[model samples]
Target chain A: AQSVTQLDSQVPVFEEAPVELRCNYSSSVSVYLFWYVQYPNQGLQLLLKYLSGSTLVKGINGFEAEFNKSQTSFHLRKPSVHISDTAEYFCAVSEWHSGAGSYQLTFGKGTKLSVIP
Target chain B: DAGVTQSPTHLIKTRGQQVTLRCSPKSGHDTVSWYQQALGQGPQFIFQYYEEEERQRGNFPDRFSGHQFPNYSSELNVNALLLGDSALYLCASSLRYYEQYFGPGTRLTVT
Candidate 1:
């Protein structure tokens, strides 16, 4: 019964500009967080994950996200964006299920990032 | 190594028809999960398979079922499909207690 909320549905950033995508989750138990990127007509590629370590998690393509437990937020940030970074990004949460002995991801509505040239 | 893969990149079906989607998990992975992604929305988990059995399932109805083979490949079958069933079906694979990798997905279009 975990859920994720992405504050923004669309984000537009100019080439070489910094951008951030906000995500928040609600869960009764501890959880893992992740960010994934999807190009047009392609499957999702894992950007980064927060299992249980540093709050700042770095990912591919110079993207990073910080896990804020108190705020229940895991916001993705990129110092600079490229035209190729224009894609849909998703924030997901995973929680262990004792009955199944596995974990399932619950994703947000998604934030479409558009990098303008 | 090959990541997760799904069959029939796209399929078109009429309402009330049945559809079957296939998936091959990544190498060395023993678990597979199916998800449904509607247009402009995130993917929703359908179910998970491990050791050739269903381990977890989401809020989907019994009309949605799945099977896993000995080779760790999986199949998702939806009976009496409705227009709302038209969406991208994604298959994800993972090692025990590990992160999951995704497939390109099978687009099911119901007209």
Candidate 2:
């Protein structure tokens, strides 16, 4: 089993400021990491995923996340944010194989990102 | 092609009543998974269906069950619903060993 922890429940940042949302996962086996964003009343959209590759992964809306194997972390960062970037972000993790005979993702509670003007 | 689609964007049900939500997967997708999202929380895995059989289940009780059709559509049925069931129910579609694509979800209100 794998679990995701997002340290920040809420993040408030000014427009055009850089921001980082921290995430950590616990899994003894190989894992896949993902970041998703949700606006009010909308379904989740995959921002980016770390299957296997370099530590840094770029996503839409100028967002990027770096996977740290040693730290068991995948933190999302952006040089600048727009007001429209305000939304809830979730960090997710999954084992390469689940005993239940399926590949399922376990998610963090969520972090609310509020962009202040 | 259309993405995953869920029916009855909004639903209201009284306690002890039953409710069924439907989902149509994205084209070319063969697996459908269900999740429950409470207010201010991330979505929780409910179950998954593949090839018209229940391929996986979560920690939820038996009151929460689902079915998958041969066409790869799915339905989540809740028996004797409770007020705690009020939340957003999301349906996601995926291929074998592929990342999931989620639908807008059905907002179920158990009054």
Candidate 3:
């Protein structure tokens, strides 16, 4: 089983200011990490994913995240924020089940980022 | 190409009523997964379908069921619904073991 924890419930930041959202996960097996952003009344949009090879992954909209295996953390960061960046951000972990021949995603409760203008 | 699509953008049901939500996968995708997102929470996986068969299921009860047709379109059916069943129903499609694309989602309200 796998679970994710998003340390912050809500983060308020001014426009053009840097921001970070913390995430941690626990799993019995190897996993993949992902970040998704959700605008109000919409489904999630994948910002980036960390399958393997790199500890630092960059994504669309100037977003990036680093995977720290020792700490079990994958925190999202952006150097600057725009008002449009206001949205609910989710951190998720995916584990493959050989028995089921599939993968399942476990998500955190989500962090609402409010970028003030 | 068209992304994932879901029907009846919003729905309202009574505690004992049943609801069926629909989804169409993105072009060229063969797998469909269903998730339920409650207010102020992340999405919880319900089940996944491939080749018209249920390939995997989550912790949800039997009251939650699904079907995938030959065209890869799918439906999520909830029987004997409760107030807690109200949520945003999300449908995601992808190739096996690939990145999944999500739909706009159907907002279900159980009153």
Candidate 4:
């Protein structure tokens, strides 16, 4: 089974500061990586994804992530963040080799990103 | 286009009762997946449906069931519910092997 581990439970950063949220995964077969952001009481929104052909994936809200196979990581980064970026970020993984009937996802707990003004 | 949507935005039920949540997939989407999101936790995969048939499921018990219609919409049914079943039930839609778009979710409160 696949699983994700998000290192930080909370991240506090001032506005205009750079931020990196760490994520690592465990999977026996190939997998697709994704990052999602969730506001309070709302469902998730896809920030970015790494399906293939790109280790560096760019996402909305000026966020990006690097898919590192050697380290089994897909850490999310932002050059500069705004207070509007405050939300809970999630790292998720899905099997790339699975058949048509299944494409289950395993998700990390989450990282609460608190962008301070 | 309008994103995925789930109906009955908020519902409250008691233990042993049954509840159903509805979802309408995004335009051009044929697959719908359901997830359970507890407070302070990431969404947990519940199941996926395509072509009006169940395609994938997670480790949840049989108490959690679902259905897909010919229109590509879906519904999640929870029977004999427990307090542990209380959570925000999210619905997402996707095309083949593509990234999914999510709905606002239906908050289920089991007391």
User: Fnat per model, in the order given?
Assistant: 0.92, 0.79, 0.87, 0.82
lDDT of 1 by residue, A15-85 (tens): 99999999999998999999999899999999999999899999999999999999999999999999999
* Residues A1-33, model 4: lDDT tens digits: 899999999999999999999999999988999
* Model 3 Cα lDDT, one tens digit per residue, A1-117: 899999999999999999999999999899999999999999999999999998999999999999999999999999999999999999999999888899998899999999998
TM-score of 3: 0.98
TM-scores for all candidates?
Answer: 0.98, 0.98, 0.98, 0.97
Worst 10 residues of 2 chain B by lDDT: B50-59
What is residue A40's positional error in candidate 1, in angstroms? 0.9
Clashing pairs in 4: none
For model 3 chain B, the run of ten residues with the poorest summed lDDT:
B93-102
| DockQ of predicted model 1 | 0.91
All candidates in order of lDDT, best leading: 3, 1, 2, 4
Q: Candidate 2 at residue A45, lDDT?
A: 93
Instruction: Write model 2 residue lDDT over A1-117, tens digit each, in one string.
Output: 788999999999999999999999999888889999999999999999999989899999999999999999999999999999999999998675555577888899999999999
**Candidate structures ordered by TM-score, highest first:** 1, 3, 2, 4
Q: What docking grade does candidate 2 earn? A: high
Per-candidate Cα lDDT values, in order, are: 0.96, 0.93, 0.96, 0.93
